[model samples]
Target chain A: MIPGYITTNAPALLIAVPLLGAFLSPLIGKISRDARALWVLAVMTLTALIGYFVAFLVYTEGTLLYVFGATNATLAVPPDSGGIPIRIIFTLDAMSALMVTIAVTVGFAVILYSLTSDARRSGLEAYYTIFLLMIGAILGMVSTGDLFNFFVFLEISSLASAGLVAYKVEKGRAVEAGLKYLLVSTIGGIFFLFAIGILYGQYNALNMAMLADMIQWTPLDKLALVLVVAALAAKCGAVPMHFWTPDAYSMAPSAVTAMLVVASQASLYGLFRICFTLYGITLNYVTIGWVIIILGILSMIIGVTMAIPQKDIKRLMAYHAVSQTGYMLLGVGVGLAVLGDQALLNSYGMTAMEGGIFHIFNHAMYKGLLFLTAGAIIYQVGTSDLNRMGGLGHRMKWTMIFFIIGALAIAGIPPFNGFASKFLIYESVFAFSPLLSIIAMVVSILTLASFVKVFHSVFMGPPLPGNEQVREAPRTMLIGMTILAAIVIISGIFPEFFVQNLITPAAHALTDQAGYISAVLGGA
Target chain B: MRMSKIVRFGADVLFGAIVIFGLYVIMHGHLTPGGGFQGGAVVATGAALVIVAYSYEEVIGMIKKTILMAQESAGLVMFAGVALIAIGLGTTFFFNFLANSGSLFGMTVPFGPNPGELNTGGVLPLMNIAVGIEVWGGLAIVILYMLSGIGKTKEA
Candidate 1:
């Protein structure tokens, strides 16, 4: 039972440590204000350690699986399968393990940063409780193998994130936004549930691997596939289903807002898993790609256009979130459209997909950094309105520096993480389709323009009405932003390293539907 | 905080029925049309029923912000808990571990031929129940907060 020493089984401690910490947070919070936050940080630190170790195990030892109930008897077929039957399965390939590492790292940073921000002293113990739950749910979502189990985790992540948005009950707008997010997110969750139901009904199994074996090109299967993709799109804030993003981000506490940004990115990973694995990618997945492409293009145009007029900084970032999603999806969509056609998929489409997936991690780093920086500014200046913020660079030098790097990274400037991913998408798209490449280029340039405006208005101009006495953010916030800023820079410089290791595995995971399905349920 | 005993009794019965039905739905998810989320929505009806029958202030005071928040968060964590076990076991995300026919409390039960059968799947029932609690508690808290927030707001 010494699982850590066993190459085939990862230590369950990675998830246990954080979850157990979450359960004890309330009780510990009563003892000291910082106790719960520090406990969470410690838990995530442990989670990251375990995640990194597990990832190292998977990388060195190959794919590792642990059946829930420890069955001594093996299944009829499929080597490395369950022993005693009726056990929850945990399978870690490189991709899932990597994501766990990223999520845990970012989560730790966020919790640490919040400890020093006004979020700590805000008498929002319940808020931290939900925050920890969210981190745990995301960890669960990324790491689990059961499809039904995945849906449940999705709901947990969604609810906790929405709760974070409404943490400030005094802001009636936040409450309203939470409600809207709930309604839409609930619908998404329901659709996901329905898709699970459909898969179970037709396949007579909820195991992803077993279900994939049972899948055939039937109308019912197509419908289930559509429902799953649609539901995921809503969660990812794809266009038409993306109405909730701006309000939810604008209304929540800044710490919560930063967390939600990362949470949403994590959900996109789910979308990729469901679409590619649950429904075999070889079958008409390309059609869905067209749909996603259309949505992505629409979001890019509309999100930037909308951002041009925003007065509030968070709201603008909110629109940009949508626009950025478009950029990510552009590569994904292109890869999907060409998946069935080997010629198109080979040269650049694969690279494009890698670009999109790479951008997911890069976006998480830069966007989370930017949002935290925004939170820092709001912490000091007490406003997220761009028109109201001026000369903040002089008052909050570290915060401003972090914000500049984040803005540069987000705007796809050279020598930044954003540019690295955007370049992949750009070059790959040009090789595949000039028109799509043109659109992507336009989006990139506009992104730069938008952040420039943010810089000029928020950081460059004369000190605004109330910023005369605005002080710098606390050291904890600086640490979080600094960590992300360094990551962004490293990713930018080591694009090849990231693509070869992290992005390629993620892209391959998304593309290798058979591998994903077989790994989860067993070989068909 | 005072209300007629009859009114209070009626609300209690209604809530009791809804709670029971929601639990049944959640537990029977593997075998039936209803699952955790649907059952959770049904449970929230009990909260709504209580809100409608009682004074808003009383209902709000009884539930309390911290408790509601805790319930919502706990439910979320519970759902994640099942997945955490799977992660620890080195299975794929959300892999069901406890899905089998085993003797529990000296009762021998048969899980049907398919893994999809009720009581056959591993951890699904538990996950479903966790989701049920989350959906029930989360929706209720969200709605209550919204209603009270809106009720007190003045038009600009």
Candidate 2:
């Protein structure tokens, strides 16, 4: 079949449209501040609506590919027949669609919240523009089928995020944190480039689907695999490479910081995409799983241990971000390990993988809510320092309540979203390794303890000297927190809905090599 | 002051050679060793050399700030445009339209999907060049911004 313009490639538009919109924004912003914000918001809202339509199209049409420019019609190819993908390839599958849904919905909520708060409103035009680009980039990263395209989108998101982190140049550590983040992300980018070069050299192909079929695990292939995994681990803030995360989170403007944390999550998605979709997990090396599990364990221990000593509320939460990532990776890693065992693979392994992916959505909600609440506190009391704050429950009742809800959810309390996923992980891990389960439980307990310190210092102690003037966060911030809080609870109550509709399909697609290859090459 | 001039002259020649070499590499990406990223970085070095050799204001004037910005945006647009066109061509996005194995300029230059004329393959080489331009322009802009900040401080 010759491709036509009306092909099912709607996913590519979700990215291209917003990218075009981003370039138009600063010019539009130059006209008037309000005009700029409105334009960006309009574009974002439109992009979100388009994203919804794409998701709908995916469900209705099944797998669809949007070729950016032009393509050859050949279904199956002789050797050296297909050329490099010169255009952007947005391939929409169950996994990509799910990620796009989360990104756009959360993005909409964040933009709406920004409108109500004056703190973020002053830098309004630049904020919305960058925010929109971030949304577009993440959506593109998830949907793109080409390997080089993935790296381009990665750089777009990564660099834009670095700029946002340093946006608050007046803040003492903001620029320093941004610089450190830049250095590490640059290194990560180089690792990705090296991997890409090796893979390209081996197969002479950059398309994920094609590469999946062509890739044979030669010594060079193994080297590329190691490099790619290491790079992604750094991006995911997996232990040891996670040093820059807390500082970057602590320094960026609250709204930006809240949005930027999702970068690491998307990068984790990148890792899963490459490992399962590109590498086909059945290959006999247990090293990948072992390495991932070790990193997960270290992240859990170190993240929680570091959190125990943090006096700054933001820094503590950042550490928790690292720790929580451990749970997510542990689930996925356990799933990988158990794949060779039949009963375990289906009942426990898939369960663990689903748990990890579900936790991605869960963390986005609870952790984002936590950061927004922290932003609210900082807005009111002008400090994220835990030791300096006291008795904030009296003044900022709603903020404290929301914070508690988020904290509880993150602590994996029953009846919250976190617990539902945590339970799956615990059951899976316990079946595999009881010792790992124990450590996971210990990390959860310590997470709760760390949040308790935040609660006691910020909301329990007597109001600090000269702190009486602090007031509740504005309605906008409240709305942001409320939306995330509601989702956290709703997801907790209705785990099956999310699992059935989103998590299961995505997990299946992640592990489905035949499905991916057939979609790209017409048939295996 | 004279030493600065000598350093500037050396930097200028080095940067020029790098820029030319980078383009040479990118143009032959499909057949040979070099590609967009390497070439683009070299192009960015040319911009950096200017900053070192002359006043920031003077360099900005020579390149034209708007032109630099336009270059960045245009590269992105071109890259996307190539991909979109590939879709229209009845295949996946970014499908290479002009990949062949051929020799050019006394050198055997591989060009398309099959070894043929320069235009035989799809649009890959074009995309590579576009990406090269974007990388060069974007990095230049960033470095210029940082350098401008330094320029401001020196005067103050």
C-alpha lDDT of candidate 2 relative to the true structure = 0.79
Winner by DockQ: 2
Candidate 1's DockQ: 0.14
lDDT of 2 by residue, B1-156 (tens): 112878878877897687888887777665566677778877888888778777887787777756666666677778777766656655555565444434222324454575443442335567768878878887888888888865667767
Candidate 1: residue A482 lDDT (0-100): 90
Docking class of 1: incorrect
In candidate 1, residue B66 scores what lDDT?
62
lDDT of 1 by residue, A1-524 (tens): 33532334344555566666766676577678767767767877777777788777766665556554443211323345342124555656666776776787678778778877755346456666678778878877877777887888889889988888877765488889998888888999999899888878877777666666667868888788788778888888888888999999888877677777767776777776666666655468668877777877887888888887889999999888888888878888888878877788888889998888888888888888988998898888877778789998888889888888888998899799999998999999888678878887887788889889988888897787778899899888899889888999999998999888777876776677677656545554
TM-score of predicted structure 1, chain A: 0.94
Per-model clash counts, in order, read 31, 36
lDDT (10s digit) by residue, model 2, range A222-267: 8888888888889888898999899888987676666766778888
lDDT of each: 0.76, 0.79
- Candidate 1: where are CA atoms >4 Å away? A1-12, A72-87, A120-123, A520-524, B4-156
